[model samples]
Target: MSSPLTLAPATGGQRPRRLLVVLGGALIVATYLFLVTVQPAEIAGGMGSVASLVTLFGFLGGGALLVAGILPMLSTSSLVVMPLGIALNIAIGQIAGSLGMQIYLDAIGTVLVAVLAGPAAGAATGALSNAIWGLFNPFALPFAAGAALIGLLAGLAARYGAFRRVYLAPVAGLVVGAIGGLVAAPVAVFMFGAAGTFGTNAIIAVFRSMGDKLLVAATKQGLLSDSLDKIVVFVVVALIVYALPPRAVRQFPFARTHRVLGGRTGALPAPSPVKAAHGGGSGVA
Candidate 1:
């Protein structure tokens, strides 16, 4: 019979790093909330472009801090994956937006990173992707928080075995997308005044025509588009993961440590009797 795997507790040294990640994530959320809710005269008046810049920098700073915290914890392989993930998010997201697809396929790379690296790294990827994309596409700036949340949630889902079965990934995605929509609605209503991508804008316009308030319309549109987008993204990521060679899959420390893909998990073997006799057995049973 195969031994049951147990996740080791975080070491004392890791606690500080974990704290840094939490603080950085908190900073991102706080900055976004301040911008959306306060609507400072500087931002609300004639300086909309400045607001976009602020949003970009705020999210970028937070993401950079989070990545700093997560750097020591990542494997070299995971580090290599980050840039590719960012590129994937930008390239696919731009294409989908250009095509006027209602569902944003932007989070595929974020989810992919989250599933492979862990939540913190995934969150960093999502936040960074939006910050960089915002440089060229100002529209993406306001949604950085939502993107980060999606990444964080995707990693958590993977950690909890959401990817263990094919069907469960979509279910997890559905939940993540619903929450993402909630996170995004205020940005749509307050920042853009119901303006968004083609599909979402059309949906919001239809809702408005039907007598829904802007906030209500934005929220509904977000729910519809985000949920569908996430379901598709998660399914695609699952297929990609499954298609990878077992050796490739095992290279991801997060996946192997957590048994996310259900293999041997690479836990250290128990000492042999002879070795134990020569050296004492480690206290672990």
Candidate 2:
């Protein structure tokens, strides 16, 4: 596997250095796109709107920075595992939908990236997961920021000893779920105009029927729906880590967080299944 840490971001060969330079250039362009766009960015090319240019620039620029931010910490193993994370977010996410479950169960890949790598890697994974998912379903683009939040928070919680004890796992889940819900509410409002996304929109519509304002109803749905989904996501991640053999766990980026390595073995965990390989996809711009 490729251990990027050994390559040294600042020192390594010219190739690695060039990679950072290119990523940096993309970031610069992304900024201009964001600020200079003539209109608000929209889906489906924005039909010649400057927002379309922003979306393109922003996607490439922001994505490059997000991934490159984790380059130094990524092992070849971590890199291999990244695509798998995106695959899980897309595939299993549908299973939950197919079953008509209230929870999303979509962040499986996001959580995986976090657990194996550090929060940065996990953040990259989460953001990319949504972007990839968007490729097939443009409606998914607005939620990239939300997914990124899920991954970052989950990874940070794990980093800080959240997974060290069995009891703490669920607590972490609730926290992540609440935050994910809050973050997603605005995105839903932006895309669907307070009707919310499909799965949770039903709930949002109910809230609206009850006389809630557009943003309020959407936020309420987010709190309820996202909370349930992310709680499930976090808890499952914990469980997966708990069940993993030390060797399997060790190869991941955040292996040090495992209670097995941290001198505890009795912590409760939530969920995940590591297949180690899968195809990839993007969400929206």
Q: Quote each prediction's TM-score.
A: 0.75, 0.69
lDDT of 2 by residue, 1-285 (tens): 866665445565323344553564465444433433333433222343444344445545555565565566566777788798899889987888788876668888888778767676777788788888889987777566567667778888878888777677678888888877765654455345545457676787788789876556777787777777766777787778778766676566456545432553323342323322333222111
What TM value does model 1 have? 0.75
Which structure among the candidates has the greatest TM-score? 1
Model 2, runs deviating above 4 Å: 1-64, 97-100, 195-199, 257-285
- lDDT by residue for model 1 over 8-27, one digit each (tens)? 76575643377667777787
After TM-score superposition, the amount by which residue 14's alpha carbon in candidate 2 deviates from its true location, in angstroms, is 9.0
The root-mean-square deviation over C-alpha atoms between each candidate and the true structure, in angstroms, is 8.1, 11.6
Q: Which pairs clash in model 1?
A: none
lDDT of 2: 0.65
Q: Which ten residues in a row have the lowest lDDT in candidate 2?
A: 276-285
